[model samples]
Target: MKKIKVMHIIGRLPVGGAENLLLTIVRNTDRNRFNLIVCCLDKEGQIAEKIRQGGIKLVCLGTTRVRHSYRKIRRLVELLRHEQIDIVHTHLYKADFWGRLVSLLYGVPVICKTEHGDVNSFKNKPFYFKAAEYLCFNKILDRLSDGIIFISEAQKKEFEGKRIKMKNSFLIHNGLDTKRFSSSNKRRSQDRSEKLSKNNIVIGVVARLSDRQKGQSCLLLAMRKIIERYPEAGLLVIGSGEDEGRLRDLSAQLGLDGSVSFLGVRDDIPELLAGMDILVQPSVSEPLGVSILEAMYSGLPVVATNVGGIPEIVRHGETGFLVPPKEPDALADSIIKLIDDPAMAREMGEKGRETVMSGFTGDIYTKTLEDLYVSLLKRKCRNRNYRYADLFEIT
Candidate 1:
C-alpha cells in the first residue's frame, strides 16, 4: 500500500497554461495517494517558484540554450531511477521527448504526455526555421511515451490525422479554481475598483507579447478602431515576452498612448480579470485557453479568435463573440457591440460563470486526472501480466 511517486516534466515552468495545469496537479492531488516531483528542463520561471512555495520537490535539468543534450538525459534517468518514480508525466515538447526516453531507460512503468497545443498549426509557420523545429519535435513525440493526453478534442483529432499511433489518447479540458477566481475576494475587488474607476469600461488582454503566435499586433489594430468610437474605453495588457518593445511602438504609432496600458508580467491576474468588462484573446494560434476559463470564472465576457479549441470554450453568441483569427476589423466590431450594450455583456458574463462553475472547476479537473492515472496504471498491470503469460507459453 505504498504511495505512487508521480513526476511531472516540462520544458520550462513559465507562466502559461501548461505550467498552471502542472501547478494545480501538484497542489490538488491527494498527497496520501501520490508523491509529486517537478522536473523542469530549462531554468525555472515564476511558476517554478510557486511550485516550490507550495512545498513540492522541484528539479531543474539546467539545460542551457543548447538542445538535446544526452548527458542531461542520462542525469535525468539516474534521478528517476533513484527516486523510484512510478509514473512519468510530461508536458510540452522537450519534456515529452527527453522525459519519456529517460523514464524508459530507468524502467519507469507508466509514461504519459499532455499535448497542450495542436501540432498541425506548425504548417502555418512562414519561416523555414519554425517549420523545421516543428518537424523535428513531431518525430520525437511519436517515438516517446505510452499514452497521450490532449487539452481538447480538436487537438486530438489533429494528432490523429498526422498518423501518430498513440494507443491511449484522451481529451481533458483545462480547469480553474472558481472560488479563487470569484469576484467576492476583498483584495481583488479593491484592486479592481482602483484600476478601473466606476464609469470606465475596461477591455483587457492577458497573454505573452509574442507577435508570431499571440497576434498582439492584430489586437492593436483592432484597438485603433475601438478607440475611434469609444475614446474613453481603456485597454490593459498583462504579461510580457519578446514582442513587448515592438508592440509598445506599434501602440504609440497607432496613437494609443493614453488609452492603452501595458502592465507587463503581472501576478495579479484574478484581480485584473475582475477589473475588466471584457476579455480578449487575439491569438493567431492557440490550444485550450485557460485564460478564457479564468475570465469566465471571474464573470467577464470574452472576445476571442475562432482558432484551435477556442470555439470549444466560447459559445459564439452565448458566452462570448468568436471572430476569425487576424481579423482586426471583425474583432473591433465584436468589442464595440459588447461595449455598447452593457446589459448583454453582463448576461453573457453571468452565463459564462455558470459554465465554468459547472464544468471547468479545478476540483473536477484534478478528479478527472486522478481517474485517468488509476485507469492507466491498471491497464499497464494487465498488459504486463498478459506479456508474462505469453513468455511462459514460449518457454
Candidate 2:
C-alpha cells in the first residue's frame, strides 16, 4: 500500500504545550503506513532539531515578517506539489491562515486545523487583532477545513459559544509518553530520596512565567500564604518567558526570595517532576493543562484552577483538587490540605497516574490521530470515486 503523506505546518517548534504535542505526534506516528513532514513558517527551534535527528523531513521557511509570508507561500505550494501531500494539518495562527490558504488553493485532499487555545486566548489582545483572528479562524477556516481537532471540551464549547458550527469537528484529548516519566521516576527515585529531606515539601509549577495568561502571580500570592503554615515548603517555578523579571521581583517583594526558585527553561522535565511533591497550575485561562497530566504521570498530586478543561481531568476530590482561578486563598487552602495529609496526597497521585495510563498515552494519541486521518481520507476518496491506489497518482 502507498503511504499517506501528511504535512504539519506550524509557526515554530518552540518548547511549549502545542509544540510538545506536535513532537509526540511526529515521534510516535506509524511510519509504516504514513509519511510525516513538518514545515515551520519561521526559523526551526529546538523541537525541529529533534525531528531532524529522528530522520523526519523538515522544511524551515526563514521568513520572519508577515509580508515575507507571501513569497514563502509560493515556496510552500512548490513543496506541496513536489511531495504530493495527501493531508495538510496546521497549528497556531500563522500556520492556520497560510497553510489552509495554500493547501486549499493547491487542492489538497484532506485539510485539518487544531484549535489549541481556549476562547480566553484573545481576551488581552487588541480589538483589531482579535477581529482579524475571528475572521480567519471562524469565518474562513471553519467552513473550508475538512475537520477541526479540539484538544479539550472547553475549547470546543468556546468555539460553539460564538455560534460557529463545526460539523466535522473531533474532540481528541492530548497525551504524552507516560512510560518516559515512569522510567525516569524509577531511575531517579533513589537519588531524589537521598538529596531531599523528608520534612521539606516542594510545590512545583511548570508554565511560561507570563502572569497575564498563566497567572503565576496568583501562585506567588498563594505561596506567601502557604509559607505561614508550612515553613519548610519551597516553590519551584519551572519555565522562562517575558514575565520572568516581574515575577522574580514579585517573589522578592512577597518575602518569598528564599521560598521560591525560578528555574528557567528545562529539558529535564521528567526528572524534575520526580522531585516535586505537588503540582499547581494557577492559570487564569487554560485550554488544557498538560503540566497537570505530566505531574500525574510522575505520581504527583495536582492542585489546579477549575477553569477550561482542567475540571475534565481533575475529579475535584479524586485525582486532585480544583480551586477557582486567581483566588490565592483557595489555592493555598487546597495545597495546604494536600500537605496536611500525606496519605491523601499519595492516594490522589496514584489515582492521577492511573488516569493518564488508562486514557492518555502518546501511543493512544498518535493512533487516534492516524485513525482520524485515514477516516477523513477515505471519505474524500469515496466522494471522488477514487481508489486508494489511485490517490497517490493524483496530480
Candidate 3:
C-alpha cells in the first residue's frame, strides 16, 4: 500500500500547547502508514530543531513581515504540489488562515484544522476582530475545511454556542507520553540540588507569561494570600512570555517576590514537576493543559481553574481541585488545602496518574488520529463529490 503523504502546517515551533501537541502526534504516528512533514508558516523556535533532529522533514518559509503571506502562500502551494501531499493539517490561527487558504487553491484531498480553544478564545477582542471570527472563520473556512477537531467536548460546545454550525468537526482529547513523566527524576544536577525546605510546600505553574488568558496576575494575588497562611509554602512559575515584566512587577507589588520564583522557559518540565509538591494552572480559559497532565502523571496534585476543557481532565476531588476562574481567594484556598494535607495530596496525585495511564497516552492519541485519517480517506473514496454532512463522530 502506498503511504499517504501528510503535511502539518503551524505558525511557529514555540513552546506552546498546540506546538507541543503537534510534536507529540508527529513523534507517535505510524510512519509506515503516513509520510509526515511539518511546515512552519512563520519562523522556527526551540522545538523546530527537535523535530528536524528526529529525522522528519521540516520546512520553514521565513515569513517575517505582514506582506510576506503572498510569497509564503505561493511557496507553500508549490511545495504541496511538488510533494503531492494528500492531507494538509493545520494548527493554530495563522496556519489555519493561510494554510487552509493555500490548500483550497492547491486542491488537497483533505484539509483539517484543530481548534485548541473555542469562541471564548476571542472573548476580549476588538469589534473588527469579532467580525473576523463571524465572517472569516464561521462563514468561509467552516465549509472549506474537511475535518475540524476540538480537543475537548467543552471546546466543541463553546464553538457551537457562537451560532456556528460546523459541518465536519470532532472531539479528540489531547494525549502525551505518560511514561516520560512516570520515569525517575531527570532534572539536571543543578536543579536536583534545589529543593523546597522541610516545612515548605512548593506550588508550581508551567505556562507562558501571556498578556491575557493565562491568569498569572490572579495567581500572584493568590500567592500573596497563600504566603500569609503558609509562610513555608513557595510558588515556582515556569515559562516566559511578553507579560513577564508586568507579572514580575505585580509579584513585587503583592510582596510575593520573596516566596515566588519565576524560572522562565525550562525544557525539563518533568524534572520541574518532580521538584514541586503541587501544580497550579490558573488560566482564565484553558482548552486543555499538557502541564496538568504531566504533573498528574508525575504524581503531583493539581489546582486548575474550572474553565474550558480543564473540568474534563481534573476531576475536582479525584485528581485535583477545580476553582472558579479569576478567583484569587478560591485559588489560594485550594492550594492551601493541598499544602496542609500532604497525605491526601499524594493520594490524589496517584489517582491522577491512573487517569492518564487508562485514557490519555501517546499510543492512544496516535491510534485515534490514525483511525480518523483512514475514515476520512474512505469517505473521499466513496464520495468523489465535495459536499459531506459531518466530518467528525469522535465520540
Candidate 4:
C-alpha cells in the first residue's frame, strides 16, 4: 500500500510543547507507513533545524506576521499542490488558519487542527489584542478543519463551549519519551551544583518568560517568601521570552539577586531537571504541560499551579503537589513543604516517573495517533464511497 503523506503546519517550530509534539510524531511514526513533511508559517527556529537534520523536509512560508497574507497563502497552496500533501495537520493559530485555507484550496483530503491552548483564554482584552490578527482569522480556520485535536479534556471543553463548529474533536494528551529520559542519566550533579551552587536547595522552572500565561512573577514572589524562610533556597529559571527583563527586575526588587539565577534559553533541560529536587510550573494558563512529564520522568517532584489540564496529570497528593494559580503564599508553602521533606519529595518523584513510564511514553503516544489516523482515513473512505453511490444511483 502507498504510504500516507502528512504535512504538519505550525506558526513557528520553537522549543514548545506543540512543536515538540510535532517533532515526536515525525520522528516516531512508521516511515514506511507515512511520509511526513513540516510546513512552518514563519521563520524556522532551532527545533526546525533539528527536524531538517533528521532527514525530514521542512518548508517555511516566510510570513513575518499573520495579517492578511493572501500572497503567502497562495504560495502555500501552490506548495501543497506541488507536494501532493494528503493531510495537513496544523498547530497554533496562524498556521491553523492559513494552513487549513491553503489545504482546502489545494484539495488536500485530510485537514486537522490541534488546539494547544484554550482559545477562550483570549476573551480577555489584553491577550486578545496581542493576538488579534490570528483570533480574527480562527473562525474561518475552525470551520475549514476536518478534525480538531485537543491535548487535554479541558482544552476540548473550553473550545467546544466557545461554539466552534468542529466536525471532529479528539483529546490526545502529550507524551514524553520516558525511556530516553530515564535511561540517559546524563545529569552531571557537580556541574549542576556549580551552576546552581551547593548551599541552595534549587527549585527549577522551565518555561518561556511570558508574564501573561506563564505567571513567572507569581513564582518569583513565592520564591521571595521561600528564600526568607530557607535562606539557602534558590530559584533557577530556564527559557527566555519578552518578560525576562520584567521578571529580572521583580527579582532584584525583592532583593533576590544572589538567590535567583535566570538561565535563559537553556539547552540542558533534562540535566537541569535532574539537578533540581523540585520543579515548579506556575502557569496562569496551560493546555497540558509536557515539561511536567519530562520533569517527572527525570525523577523530580513537581509543584504546579492548578490550571488547565495540570490536575489531569498531577494527582494532588500522589504524584505531585498542585497549588492555586497566582497564590504566592500557597506556592511558597507547597515548595517549602516538599523541600523540607526529602522522603516525601522522593516518593512523589518516583510515583511521577511510574506514571510517565506507564502512560506517557512515546511509543504509546505514537500508537494512539496512528490508530486515530487509520480510523479517520477509513471513515473518509466510507464517506467517499457513499457519495459515489449517491451520485451514480448505485447501491
Number of the top candidate by TM-score? Answer: 2
Local accuracy of candidate 2 as per-residue lDDT tens digits, 78-150? 9999998999999877787788888999989899988888765665544654786766654577688898999
Q: What number of clashing residue pairs does each candidate have, in the order they appear?
A: 0, 0, 1, 0
Residue-level lDDT tens digits of model 3 in 50-91: 788777999999883456767987899889989988788888
Ranking by lDDT: 2, 3, 1, 4
Give the lowest summed-lDDT range of ten residues in model 1: 386-395
Every model's TM-score: 0.89, 0.93, 0.91, 0.89
Ranking by TM-score: 2, 3, 4, 1
Model 1: per-residue lDDT, tens digit, 143-193? 555678888877778777876556678888887855455447333433433
List pairs with backbone clashes in candidate 2: none
Which candidate would rank higher by TM-score, 1 or 3?
3
Worst 10 residues of 3 by lDDT: 188-197
RMSD of each: 4.7, 2.7, 4.4, 4.5
Q: Candidate 1's C-alpha lDDT?
A: 0.79
Tens digit of per-residue lDDT, candidate 4, span 325-379: 9899999999888767667777787888888888887778888887777676666
Cα-based lDDT for every prediction: 0.79, 0.85, 0.81, 0.78
lDDT of 3 at 158: 78
Native-to-model Cα distance after best TM-score fit, residue 206 in candidate 2, in Å = 0.4
